[model samples]
Each structure stands twice: as structure tokens, then as C-alpha cells.
Target: MTLKLLVFIHLLLLIFMAVGCNAQHSPEDFDQVNLINSAGPYLGLVVPNSFELAPLLDPSTFIPSKNVSHIDLSGRRFHVGIIADQKVIVVMTGLAMTYGQGEDDELAWESNGDYTRDIGYIHFANYSTEESCDNLLNNVWFNPDEIFPKNGIPEVREHAFWVNVSETYYNLAEQLQNVTLESCINSTTCLPTTPKIVKVERGCSASILAANAAYKNLLHEKFNCTLIDMESAAVALVSLSMGKPFIIIRALSGLAFSNLASKNAVIALTKFFELLSDKPTNGIEMYDK
Candidate 1:
């Protein structure tokens, strides 16, 4: 199947599920609840920070609604617009995934990297090892690992397993296994291989960057994590608490302990949103088998 079909399938599942499993909230002390409730069944597209948000908000990708005004609740500013024809509310979580130094550092990449490792959509986040792992220079962060039921983790939860992407989305991600991703910064500064989409079984989120090759290997070997980041697992926990469906799309810019892969993030994101624009906004149509 083509990437366009894959993109359509994803958006279809996202919106359909969003509409079907709409969660209602009681009015609380803050009037922000009322404003957000009136926003109507939007696909909440979240990013870690402005760097990731810029691509989605770009004129070529996200088209703002002229009729509706933007909403500011709490400190977060939400932009309601049409992206790839689907109505979405875009917001930045103001989080960071990158830490430690690049190049010249002990943890810097020392060899040629796999440029073909971009674009991974996760099925599960392994936050189970948070308490066991060391913190970022002794700073304490919220432990999402402890919020689960005491009887150990189950295969699925009643409210969709913390915005679980579902087995269907996992299978759909397999279609992009051959999709080409950006691998070069410039002619002379290109990676050795082209990037491709991956189906991540488990991704771990913590405060520290996986800058050490040994540390990266430890997480992979011990936890069976395909990738590590700073925020997805926490987001998963929050979504689970709120009883929502969600998915995380991770664009790999560089490999841990290898050559610093640069510019691939922008390249991968540009390609990603471009594919999103191919489908009709309403997304009522079904994909052919």
C-alpha cells in the first residue's frame, strides 16, 4: 500500500475513535474546563515543544479556521485548525527530549550512523523501570511508573490502555516499513543509509538522555525498548487517567553513541505532514484491503 493510504488509515482511526469514545468532564473551579469542553471533539495533536510545533503550524501544512477564534486555557495556547483536512487542536507541552552535549563529548557519536532509523510509532511505553533508573543529576521528576494498578500491568485497560494506539495501528505501521525517510543534511554531509519507518514495541521515557552506548544497550536488553525519550510515557499515563486514545510519532534525528544525525528530523517531519495532507479532511472514507 502507498503512504497516502497508510496516512488515511491513521487519521481515520484517530478521529473515529476520538468521536466514539468522547470523555466528558464535570465543571470544576476553573472556567477553562468550559472553554475546552466547547471546543468540540477535536483531535488533540500535541508536541514536546515549539521546535516540533513549528512544522505542524506552518502555512503549508496547518490551515487555521477563519471563523473560530484561538483559545488560551491555563498557560497553554491551543490553535484550532484544519490539518490535512482534519480538524485538530495543536498544542505544545513545552517539553524537551534532548539533553547532554553533542560532538567532542564523551557520549558523542564516534562512528557512522544509521540514517534509515527515523519515524517510529510506538505501541507500548516502558515506564516500569523509572524508580530503578537514576535521575538526571539528582533532580526528581514525576514517576509515571507508579500510577498503574498494583497487580502488575495488564495486556489492555478498559479505557484503551493509556491511549493505546491499538493493535490495528500497530499493524498499519508495518505498511511504512519500506517508506523512505530523509537521511542527508547536504550533499557532502549525508548519512550512509536512508531512513525507514519502524514499529516500536516499547519506548522508555526518563529524565536523562540515552547518551551512552552501554546505557542505551542496557535499556534495550533489559526492558526491550526500541527507543527512549523524555515525555511519551508520561503523556501515556496522563491520557490513560483521562480515558483517551492517543499515539506517539517519534522522528529520529540522531543515533545514540553514533554519528550525530542532523536535519533528518525536519526532513522526516516535512515528509510526514505532507503525507497527512493527501487525505480529505473529514476522513469518512474507509481504506481498501
Candidate 2:
């Protein structure tokens, strides 16, 4: 063969290999047993105050017909053990707080005085007085600086699993301290004399922008996957930027304080678990891939 022809063939082979490496995984390609085992931190954020996986704890309900042990990480729980001779580990983490009366008020945001209203941008204005804000900042898990220091980054355990529910929106709201007039233009009405609107965004919806921006910075710093659940786009962005696989699963619990039944929380959990078991639907896997 001519030397030029040989070089061309080599280049084609390289291209083929590169494409093969980046190819997406099909349902058939994933071993069902392997997938179940690989799934970690089936994190469920915005979980109801009464939420409980006690059913999972009951071997009769859904525990695989193998060695499956359940561990309760405070409110975060999961099943770990071998299933069908394959090791299956599932971790479930609750949201930062629950929603409802007599719940962790720190995690809950309020619009007027009642916790029923959506307290979007208001969190920024109320952060200093919010107890939940203090807990989140001081909490070892939420604060990256406390968990992973700047000087020496600790090695994350390959199997050490963690999952989050849809709590990022609230978390972001808690973090945002100030808002400029430019960002809130149409969504909010402001006076020209003031130049800036002091109105709070209620639910940390405004914080989403800032959180996603910060996530980008974190991604550049490290290659890791960050899975953000529904209402947790900000957290997901941070995880995505780090090159980490971020899986977000959001269950529609209910509209904010619309007299919705508590049963909705259970239904949301069911839907979330269904999503977890079935192949990616509604293009949910696009971000993860």
C-alpha cells in the first residue's frame, strides 16, 4: 500500500474509535441488573413532612429477592446489598426541608406571613432572619467549603452515594441577598426614583440564575456529574459544570398552596420511582448523557 493511503486509513480508524467512545447508551445496552445496582442517591427533594420509605424497608413490598439492606441517613434512606447476585445500592436523600404546617420553617419560605404563599425572591430579603438559611449554610453537606475545602480536595468515594430531591430552587432563594432592577424588569414592577426594586422573589426562583452561574464555575474546577431534581436546576448546573453526571427527577407534588391534598406527595413519589425504574422518558436523560 502507498504511504499516503496508509495514513488516510489510520485517520479513518481514529475517527471511528472516537465516535464509538462518545456514543449514547441504549436501553438494550444497559444490563437491568447493572443499572439498578449503579443507581445511587435516588434523591427525592421536596419530600412531604410525612414522607417515609417504610414500605421499601418491608421486604414484602419491593425489596429485591436478594440481600438488600436499608440504611437511614437521618431523613435520607436507601437500600444497599446484592440483588440477583449483582450488587445493588440505592440511596435516597430528602429535600433540605419538608413542606406543611409544623414542619421545618427554616426550609420553608413565606410570601406574606403564612408559609402558603410562594416566596420567590423574598428569600434574599429574609435570609438574615430565616433559620433555615442559617442551617443550610452551616450544614456540613450543603456547604461545599465545609465538605470539600479549597486547600485540599478530599477524594470522593466511588460508591459513596448521595441524591437530592427538588430543593435547589428554595436553596438558591436562600442564598440570593440582593437583586438589581435590570434582571427583574418585566416580571417585577419598580419605581424609577428607587432605581432598584426591593421586592423579594418569594421561592428562590431568582436564585436559579445565580446558582447555575456558580455551577458553571464549579464545573470548570472539577469534572463530575451533578444531578438536580425538579426545582433544583441550579444544583444540577453546578454538578454538570463539574463534568459529573447530574440526574434530576422532579415529581409534581402540587401547585404552591392551592389546597392540594397531601396524597399528592405520595403520588409524586410513585411517579418519581416509576421514572427511576423505566428508561428515560420525556428527554429527561438529555442533560445526564
Candidate 3:
């Protein structure tokens, strides 16, 4: 009787130990809402500043947990936040163009005969916009122009050699209605109470240019842009590739060729906040998987 009891006890202990080991090695559910990810399906907003995210997120509701340790993009820091019960990631797209120091800066080659600074936005294509991991396993993209009707971002039909800006997003004018442009001429301090959100059917993004002043024709006419920015085109490409809905609201800075020689960063920032704060009724279900 005593020997049988000992065997039973030992067998029970072994069974318990095996169960514990399996639990310890079990995989984690990445779908759960956490500091680094969204609680539900998500929307991606690629903008330049934290304030820019305000239109979609409330500052007080921010999780306060910084998401700076992505293994793939460890060096690059990103912030994750929740907005309207959806996960939203804000990424700042930096400058898109650069060149190397050589006799012919455009045609410089290294000892290995590779172009210097050849690795531009093209190298890490989609690097900045990948922060928001909201994509359906299968998605059907619609013509943004047909759906939104206002489709404000730039539209480039034929690709240019040095320029690759094309595509469009929702209309900022309609989504962010009743915006008025500032007219505080001769001084930056007294900006208009409301800045205009110039929605565009066609626009372009490129390096800072004084084409407006030099050409007398609207610089936008020269580049076919009603809007211009350093990173809009690349951001558009990123969102479109992911099959997620995207929109851009650009506050009208001084005309590219205007005599002001100034940009109303405040207008852009404020308008972004206003639009985000005013939630839209329209949105795509990028998480219906």
C-alpha cells in the first residue's frame, strides 16, 4: 500500500511539472491592446508633429507610454496613441532628397562606383509610414477621388525624372470645413483667425522653391501643385500601399513665390488640430479581417 501511494504522488508531480513547462513556453497574443499596439483595427496619420495628431487623438487620453523600441526600426522613434476607439500611429516624414559632395554633385560615384547618398527615401521606401500596422489580409482599394469627391492631395499622372509625387487622399476642405486663410501681411504675429485649407485636385511636392515670385505665374502652375510639402508624396505612397485610408490637410503658407518669404507653420498646425478634433463620419474598415 505505501509503495503504491509513493508512485501515485510522484506521477502527479511529474504531470504538474510538464503542464507548467508548456504554459511557460506558450506564445503571446500580439492582437491584444498594449502600449505599442492598438486595441482594435487602426488608421495611420503620417504628419510632422505631435500636435498634428490632435485632430484624431485627445492629448489627455494619450497612453503616455512611448513606443521607441521597435526592433526593426530601433533607432527611429515613434509614438502610438488611441483615437475614437481606433489605434492611430503618427510618423514624421523627414526630408526626401539629398546629394553627396563631389565634382559633379549629381553624377558622383564612390570607390566602388556606387552613387554617393544614393540611398534616399527610395532606399527605405515605406520606412516612415510602416509604423501603423493596420492592413486587411485582403483589401479592395477605391478611387479616392470618386469616394471623397474633394480628393485634396496632389495628383501626378505622368511620373517625372526627379519627382515621384502622385496619388491623393480625402479632401481636407470638406472634412475640415469653414477654414479661412490668414491675411496678416507684413508681420507673422497677427495671423488670420482661421487659415484656409486649400483643397486640391492636383498638386506637387518638391524642394523649397521661389518659383511663385520668379515666374509671376503661381508656382503651383509651374509644378501643377496647389499644395507643396517635403514629405506628402512619400506618405501617400506608404498609406496607399498598405491599403489604408489616408488624408492630408495643408494650411496655406505664403505662396511659394510670394514676397512674404515666410510660411505660416502655425496655421498648418492649428488647422490640423481643428480637423482632427472634428471627427469625420466617413472611414474605411481596414481591419475587417
Candidate 4:
């Protein structure tokens, strides 16, 4: 073969090798890098993707994903501001439906949902509060909410669900003393306001019903938490394992077990981000009693 022909053959071989390497990269191969971590204090903002989370981000910079949901591609994931400086990474901990459809495990998941999909998010699930919250609904065949007698008082009132929002953040309230959210673009009536600081021992994020009387009371008595959501616990879990400073703040737009207006959800998330940019209140500590 001529010299030119041989050079072309070598170029093709190089291209093939590059393509092969790229294609071989599975989700597990990239897990460590993509999972959130910081050498100093970092914030992991977990929310369900809804009108609730949208207005909190900068205008249009954090729009919904146009890409399909892929386990490794992170089509549903995105960032705001500078990661190094702001230390903020917004996480959309998908709802009950999203978990069943996307993940591949059944351990923590309770549902008409099955765990047969990509468990690329396992690191997050595995990391929520130490001890893995294994006893969250301990000794119950059905979910605690399912099996707990409709009228029966909880048997496990002192159960500690767990939290990983680091001790550093517990006293970081001084940093947020002067901040406020002045407005919300996506909301007409959600209205901008200040965020509150609370030392919520255990935060649970799930369906609206989970925030109701029997279930809500159980969390309050067992874990000493009064707020509810499906996102916080899981986020706290991941933060603990990663050794990042984390906290979950929520607002009560509507009473739990009552009609939760969309605006209420939006308002709660609004305060969450505002709190993210600042620290909790100083002097007045969130009490355990």
C-alpha cells in the first residue's frame, strides 16, 4: 500500500479505539465524580421538580430538561451559580413514580413501584442519615403508614429516623440574618418572603398524605420531626455519607392533611432556596421541645 493509504488506515484505527473507550463507560464508572462532595462546606438542595422548585433558581438558567431520562446522562440534573463558590447543587429527588421507574432496588422503596431500573442514584439512597434508617418502619411487613392501625397510637414514638445535616450547619444561622427573597417570577401569589431556621431532627419528604395526622404524628413522636417531604431524608442520607454540610428547611403553605394548594408548595420551595443562599437565624435556636 502507498504511504497515504497506510496513514489513513492508522487514523481510522485511532478513531475506532476512541469510540470504543467512550462507549464502554457505564454509569458506575462515573458515579464517584458526579456525586456531590466538597472539601469545605457544601449545600445539597433536594426538591421534587414542580412549580415548587422552579422560581427559586435564576431566571431561565435552570429550566426543565429537554433530554430524556437516562441513568448516567443526568438529563434531569443541572446546576446553578458556581459550584466551587456557592457550593450549591440542586437535586430533583423524583416522586414515588419517578423512583419506581428509574431505580433498580426495592430496599428503601415502598410502592406499587418495583425496583428494576437503573440504580445509578443508589449512592444518594445509601448515604441518607447514618444507620441507613433501617428501622424507619421497623418490624412491619407493610409500610408503617400502611400497617399502623388506623386509630392506633404509634408503638415506636422514640424511634430516631436519623439526620446528616452536619453540626457545622447547626450553628451557621448567623450567616442568614439579613437575607430575603424579594420576589418570585413563576408565581403570581406565592409571594417572596424570608426563610425560617429550625433544627428539625428528622425530615420526611413524600406524598402529601404522608404529612397527615397519623403519619405526621408518628414522625413527630418517633423522630422528633414535624415537617414532611420525600426529598429531605434521602438528601440528608447522601450528605452524611459524602461528609458535606447539609440542612433541610421547609415552609408550611397549607396545613398538612388539608388541601395543599399548588401555590403552597411553590412558596415552601421558594423559602428553601432563599435559606440556601443565607444561614439560619442567630440567637433564637430552633428548639427540640
Candidate 5:
């Protein structure tokens, strides 16, 4: 879809924090030169892998017709379909980074984690300490520098970059913060409390998939980021560079190496789509949390 149309529909991009582990490669690895330019108008849904994709594919949510188009570009597959009466193009993101890697069956997703919220702003930083940031800039695998120049985005720097989520979309999310979400994975497994949306002051995005408590603490205490992610910053940068408004809704599956995180990313997304179907007025007032 064209960038303007993407913003028009309030393309609420749902990206889970857990997906950070799978994105270890660059998009150029797939040779997707015209991937975005040639696409049609549709809401774009980006998920990290199958675990997140499974919920959306349920017949209750996604409806596909015989006229569905399956376009294979490089190693990634794009599925065009309908969801909540909105035409959508759903694609599993991080494919290029994981193309050659074999299946990771051991990987699991949980919906009960801390800081499950709709993101308002993103702060990008190096995965390593400042002492190593320079080294990382020179040796990183998925450097944004190469892509930014072509898109007219500012060149990547060894320091951090900050960007804001679309105010329109953020306000919509703010309205949904109090909406209750499913807390049970099944009758036997359940969360102590249901998931709810909250506005984060900032979210830290780096290429590294962090599972260390010390690092997670640094992001919180030092950067003032309530959540950590790997993809949203890059997505935010590209969207801003094109002057397209976007919002990233994130659900925490777990906390840095802690197995206690819940699995509500899908549940959160389902609630979001249900709201989109209603086409709510953007006039809803929101408060900072």
C-alpha cells in the first residue's frame, strides 16, 4: 500500500518484544528493492513469526477469498486478505533475518508480561555500552545507515535516535487502555490480572535481543524506557522519513530471561482489530498514564 493510505487506516502495527531474537540479518539479504512501492492499498499487519500469526489467521478474524494473491518476493511471503472488514496485507516480519535458519520449535510465546502497552515514543540506542558503540557501528549486521541515505532519513549515528509515534494512533490506543483483555491461556493456565493498554513514556529499540536483567534495568532506569523492542525504532524512522504516521502496539510475552511473562500479544491485537471494525471517531480524549 502507498504510505499515505497506510497512515489513513491507522495501520496499528503490532510488534511483540520477543521477536527481537529472530531479527539478526538485514532486509537487503532478501533483495526487496520494490517491495513497498508495488503493493496495493491495505492495512499492513507485521508479526515476528508464526506464533503471533496463528491468532490472526483464525477464521473468526481473517477471511480470505479464492481471489487471494500470494506474492513471493525473495524469501518472504505476503498474504493479502480481509480482517475486521478491512483489506489487509499480512506478512511475517524478520523473515529475511531468519531465512536460512532452521525452525526453532523450542521457542514459545506467553502473553503475561510486564509493561504491555501501546507505545507513544521510541528511543533507539546501541545494544552495547558506549565503549562498544563505535565498534558496533562498524560491525553491525543490520545497519540502518545504508537504508536511511536512500530514503532521505538522517544517517545512523553511534548515539541514540528518538522519534514519536503517530499522535492520532496513540490517542486511539489511549482510549483502549482500560479495555479488558483475556487473561487465560486456557482454563488451567491464567494470568493474575487481565492485560490492559497503557501509554509508555518511551520504548528502547536496539538490534540486540536482550534477555539480561542488568541490560533491561539499564533501559528502564537510565533511558527511562518502559519497554524494550528491536523493530519499532527502525519502523518508526522509516515511517517518519516518508512522512507517514504510524503506531506500534506491543505486548510483552516475558521479562528478560524470566519465564513468567504472559502471552497476550494476539489477544491485544484481536481487541485492536475489533475496535478498528467499529471505525471509532478520533475525537476520544486521552490522558497520560
Candidate 6:
């Protein structure tokens, strides 16, 4: 071969070697098996809101003996609670928006010129309103006999039980309802009112998106975990599109599309943990079979 031709061939070989090296150094260089324990599946516990997981926030108060860890993504403060060799992460969602703020003047007007009485009354009113609404809704929508047939009643109740107990769900529902009611009331009061979006779009928050992204990134970075629970449907979509195994362990936080509270939330969480404990981690190994 001519000198020029030989030079060209050498350059092509160098290019090929460089491409091979780059490909070898790609993100997939990390092995999934090496990151997570080969003995069991890594559980991804996701609480919808911070309040739902308040009990588990302090590891010193309640420690689990199982091989599990917890992450708290409830507010601005992110905390990880590890128990029984498991990891738990805690995250904060920031200050939640509530109804109109009560001013000192308003308090004075409401209370007989007594700050203490005003505070007590306000507290009582808040609890009373919440209890009244909860009782009304629970009696109406949660009438097992009317809502579900005898055969399906047990299944429906089982699914909704957890959500019924969670405060997060109730708070969310109350907020949405408050917004809706205020809008409707304002529209009624104002003439020539403009058209407004009355329906609250469920599960559409930047915080939620950020939390899921951070979660997936952490899983990939730390445990090389590709298989994840299907709590966040949006996250599931992204994972599924990427050809990842997205297993969902939703414990039915509430009705098909309803708010959750104390009973409902706790039951869902407890059931999820129970299911995780009962299921065989190796039932369907990811990246293996």
C-alpha cells in the first residue's frame, strides 16, 4: 500500500478505538447486581404526602426490625430514616397552601375581645368543620352496601381502607374543595363573570415531578435499580418508555379518585409494607429474566 493509503488506514483504526472506548465508558458501565443486594428486591416506599409519613419521620421513636429503609419526601427538609438494615429517605414538599389566612382583627371580631377564647374557638371551629365534612362524605360515598355489592364490597373496602385513614388525603381534598367552593361562590356574587377551570387537575405538581425525578436518579445512581414501584404514574410512564421494569405497589390510598385521610392513608401504608414483606423479591428479577 502507498504511504498515503497506510496513513488513512491508521487514522481509521484510531477513530474506531476511540469510539469503542467511549462506548465502554457509558452509563451502563455500572452493573445493577453489584449495587443492590442479590439476596432480595429493593423496596421503593413512597408516601403521597409528608403528613402521611409523620410517624416514621423519627427513627428513634419507631424502628422496624425488617431489612428496610425509608425516605421522607414530605417537605423542604429531606431526611433518611434507616431501620433494620434498610434505607429510608425523607423529603419535604414545602409549605402547603391553605385557605385564607386569619388576621388578628378577624380573630378579635370572632372572639369576645379575648385572644385566648378566639384561638380556642378557631381551633374548635376548624376541627368541627373537618369532622362534619368527613362524617357527611364518609356516610354518603363510603356506604359499602350501597356503593359495592356483597361480593365486591370486601375488595373495595380493603382498597379504600388505607386512604380513609390518611390525613394527607383529607387535607388535599379539603383544599381542592375549598378552592372549588370559593370559586363558585365568587362567580355567583360577581356579575358578567368569566369562565374558569372548575375541576382540579389531580397529580400535577412540580414538586411531585421533581421528587420522582430525584427518586429515579437516586435509584439508578445508588442501587442501579431499574425496577420501581408504580406510585407515581408519571414516573412509571418515563421508566416504561425507557424500557425499564415499573412494578406498582399501590395500596389504594383512597377511592378510585377521591381524597384520603387518617384511616385511609395509614391502612394503605401498612398494607403496602405487608405486601412487600410477603412477596418474594426474586419472583421476577430485573435485567436477569
State in Å the error of residue 14, model 2.
Answer: 34
- By TM-score, the best candidate is 5
lDDT of 6: 0.28
TM-score for candidate 6: 0.28
Query: What C-alpha lDDT do the candidate models reach, one value each?
Result: 0.47, 0.29, 0.35, 0.37, 0.50, 0.28
| 107 Cα displacement, candidate 2 (Å) | 9.7
The numbered model that scores best in lDDT is 5
Clashes (backbone N, CA, C under 3 Å), per candidate, total 5, 29, 8, 12, 9, 40
Candidate 4: RMSD over Cα atoms? Answer: 18.4
**For residues 1-289, could you state the per-residue lDDT of candidate 1 as single tens digits?**
0000011112212221123235442354134434444555555666665545665677877788664535554456767676655566666664333222345332222232311124432222243347765433453333224444324366443332223543433444455566665555557776667666666767666565566565578778866777776666656665444444455566665433012222333334344444545533343322211
In model 2, where do residues sit more than 4 Å from their true spots?
1-61, 72-76, 81-289
**Candidate 3 per-residue lDDT over residues 1-289, each given as its tens digit:** 0000000000001111123333432223222223244322334445543333343234643342344222112223334554334344444443323333334433212343433454542323233346565443334332322121123344523221222221222443354445444455555554445444444565444443222233223545554654545555554443333344444545433323121111333234344444544554235412211
How does candidate 4 score on lDDT? 0.37
lDDT of 2 by residue, 1-289 (tens): 0000000000001111123455554554344324433543232222222233342233433344242344332344435542222223344432332233233433233433324344432333343446544533342233222132223346642221232322322222232223222211234542234222121221111122122334434543443433222234444433332322333222222223211222222233333344344432222321211
Better of 3 and 5 by lDDT: 5
Candidate 1: Cα lDDT at 268: 42
Worst 10 residues of 6 by lDDT: 1-10
- Candidate 1: residue pairs that collide: 85-281, 109-258, 116-194, 116-195, 163-246
Scored by lDDT, model 2 comes in at 0.29
Lowest-scoring 10 consecutive residues by lDDT in candidate 2?
1-10
| Candidate 1 minimal-lDDT segment of 10 residues | 1-10
TM-scores for the candidates? 0.57, 0.28, 0.43, 0.44, 0.60, 0.28
